[model samples]
Target: MDMSWPHQSQPLPRRRALAAATGLAAGILLPTRTSRAAASGPTQASALNAAASYANPVIWQDFADIDVIRVGTTYYASASTMHYSPGAPVLRSYDLVNWEIAGHSVPVLDFGAKYDLNGARGYVRGIWASSLAYRPSNRTFYWLGQIDFARTYVYTATAVEGPWNRLTTISTPYYDAGLLVDSDDTLYVAYGNTTISVAQLSPDGRSQVRTQQVFTAPPSVGTLEGSRFYKINGQYYIFLTRPANGQYILKSSGGPFGPYTMRQVLLDLRGPIPGGGVPHQGGLVQTPSGAWYYMAFVDAYPGGRMPVLAPVSWSPDGWPVVQLVNGTWGSSYPSPAVPVPPRPVTPMTGVDTFDGTTLKPRWEWNHNPDNTKWSVGNGLTLRTATVTNDLYWARDTLTHRVQGPTSTATVQLDHSAMRDGDRAGLALLRDSSAWIGLERDGGVTRVVMVDGLTMDGNWNTTGTGTEVASAPVSGGRVWLRATADIRPGAARPGTFSYSTDGTTFTRLGPVFSMGNDWRFFMGYRFALFNHATQALGGAVRITRFELSVP
Candidate 1:
């Protein structure tokens, strides 16, 4: 039986007494049932196990470079955009478990002239990693990040989700700007590369007024950056992770523009640099309850780097240290006091039988989509309007955002007639640089692969298998499925299978593996595309898209 509850998905109304009563009833009710069940044996948390796991990413998906901050009663978390369009969409939570989109600070990014960020797949056109800082002196929330040619810039507002102020360009070559506001309300920023520098921001919080000064970095720490400053125990502390190593902590008597001294290597990866691996950037924050915590990005598998959080302790000498036992962070921690239910590990569920009234949030646009290419009313139909290779349909093709590996997506395609140059296919596209698609040529369908901006022949050079067959679409209803089984340190493998009806499927035998984590920055995306060709028959229709993971 398919469980489709549209009413259950809507947000509840706000009422003080009613909410209080509901909370009290929920607190008394659920645990009682769970306790009774526990007496039998260890029981399932809820009916929606996949949703619970997806909700708590630490328990399921691989989350990376997490920057989190508490604003008012809400906690907002944002991660590094591996390279998709609208940059990184910030996820918001009241406690940390139940999360929602908190609105993007960098909504409209101008990469430069000519190359609009609209799906131009190259180096860094969209938002990269960003730092979220709350400045009370001006009552402003600041988002600092790096875009393609624009370099490092800061967008400030009084709200977390904002009609943000214009970009405050910091002319420095620093990549990631870690923002901090001291006890005296002095604003400061830190960046790492060949040199680590700390500078004081002007009172308006728009520009840096003080001279940039060098901060303490161990002679052994090579090109370490992503530095952040926090005051603890009457001493200002600098917490930074070596991009090529583990994390380090330093202390200074002065403020951000400080004569700081290196304290200790809080956490260290085994072996030397360059060839030897180290965990990437991380974020550190103190909870309201006075517990010190550290959250860092870890690449557990070669191509599967995500975020993990660990607790930190202060040594007798006032140096901070990360606790690790057999060489891994603790697996579980208590959720915040606010009762956010654990989410299912799998998010996109059920058959998205596209009767076409609403478009799912799981579907994403390439860079920024043009509103004209798609319409939803009956079955969701994508109209091929633009022909220019430089147009919006080409630039902002429909794609899926990267969640994690071990997931599957199935979409129903209807392509009876297609133009000669115009092609429609189910594509697993990382960017224009790397993509693999199942395309139909004449009466035959072939699986093709592209690596770093260049498309190979019918087969992949890196051992990806291939298959050719007669075009499967005879009457209408054609189902294509893509499954990704990604292991972190190794190559992520994906397969494309097809079926005439929705039931049984035949393996097309096209296998492709994206490189391991830390080697390149990219996101996994699934898109149904129809490119314009001179041939008159190049148009396709999508009835529905269903995605699930086992």
Candidate 2:
């Protein structure tokens, strides 16, 4: 018995409301951005219990423009990370509700020079709306996406935690393309905006065999994109998102590219978050026992777009539907079939002692990093990678996604070695960045909070950052913390605090407002940086970074 309903124009039932309210009590509705580990709904033990239900936006964090697939008993999802290096984040899960960082397809943003942050920036131009597919016969996974709308790049790996190799590039861009490795192993891609097209690829999925325009959406459906390909029960289905509000399906019964028929699959505004955007633009996956689910994202920025899972049912004629409760999308659902494998630990939150040879998959650089400038052994040491007046252009600035609704990130670093004109600290990085850290000048160190940095349409730093607060400090090691209030439609401020002695902390500067504009794309990220304003050679040793839900 699958308990599900289609969208109808009616109010939610009291019982559904009661269930959501109950979960909010346990999860506490979060606060703002943490790191990534802030769990929602319930504890993992209870969350994975056979009878326990899970909430929508199943795994909260900026896993936007996601495409998911199942391999054996495990599920993996890849999402957009515009401009952030080690792009195309891949998240893995067993139960779908418990997700963890599972490496990235692009170890570094190697598309061009700007991605290196050498002298220019690629803030809103990197891997996004990518396609992920697995060819079980070959024990390989394929990842493809268009960059800056110029051309599509292809990558392949034997394992999810990969040494992914860039296979080749297609001269023509397959915008928001969806890859389908058909039953015969022939490759096809369904892509484009408003006017949708399908292209067949060579055996290895590197070049195109042929391409054709398949279906063009009506003007009333809004702009269509985020096309995902699936062949269900013999029908070749192309699922697309109107992105701002709804989802639709194009079905071709005879061939991969054909005269197809389209239908409205989902058009609803109600979701888990109050005043949040509709669920749109994510992929679907199936369970071993044959249950189907649609994984979509709801726009809840400045926290960034987060993924949600919804049950799907097939119509007698074979169209797919997104389940609803009391005429609208439900906030929670009965747990999908639980996996037999052990649950994976959550990523990003808690203490990162920097005690390993490599940073966890959750960490990404502000752009392509200068590998020679950083090292990790006992503690993460960052050498000033560039000489710049602004942090935006500095190389090797590492960032982690800011957790949603509400969260906090704290850093403890040894700044004794910081040379003159060196600045090292923690920041909520966005178009309008704000941070608190140690700034060294003339061999003297002081804690400072800087904001008021301005950027133009081109993402250039039009105005230099201003120091809002400063304090002389006497310590070899200092702790800096940033708490963000990124709940959509709220105050959305990022606050800062500092502690010289590891025991106590005091507020440093006035709350700084974070941005929610789409041009900036990637949401507020917690950044750990050590950059030089005059010359290189200075460095900072970060011993601990603790992120938590407050």
For each candidate, the alpha-carbon lDDT, in order, equals 0.52, 0.81
Error of 1 at 346 (Å): 11
Compute each candidate's TM-score over C-alphas.
Answer: 0.73, 0.91
lDDT of 2 by residue, 73-118 (tens): 6789999998998989888876776678888998888888999986
Candidate 2 off by > 4 Å: 1-50
| Candidate 1 residue lDDT tens string, 1-550 | 3333222221122101121111111111112111111233222332222111111123123345567766543566666554444455565554444445545666544554323333334332455556777876677777777665355677776765566765578766445657777767787777665366777778776676764756645577655666666665556666666665567766776655567777546445532112223444666554333334466665543223455544455566666565443354433333333322333112334566556464554454555544566666655566554454322235436665444546677887776544445555566654222333434555554434433332233212232223333343456457777777654534467777777778997666445665443434544556666666443335667777765656
Count clashing residue pairs per candidate: 29, 7
In model 1, the runs with Cα more than 4 Å from the true position are 1-63, 97-101, 113-121, 124-126, 136-140, 148-150, 157-167, 266-280, 300-304, 333-394, 414-420, 431-470, 489-491, 533-543
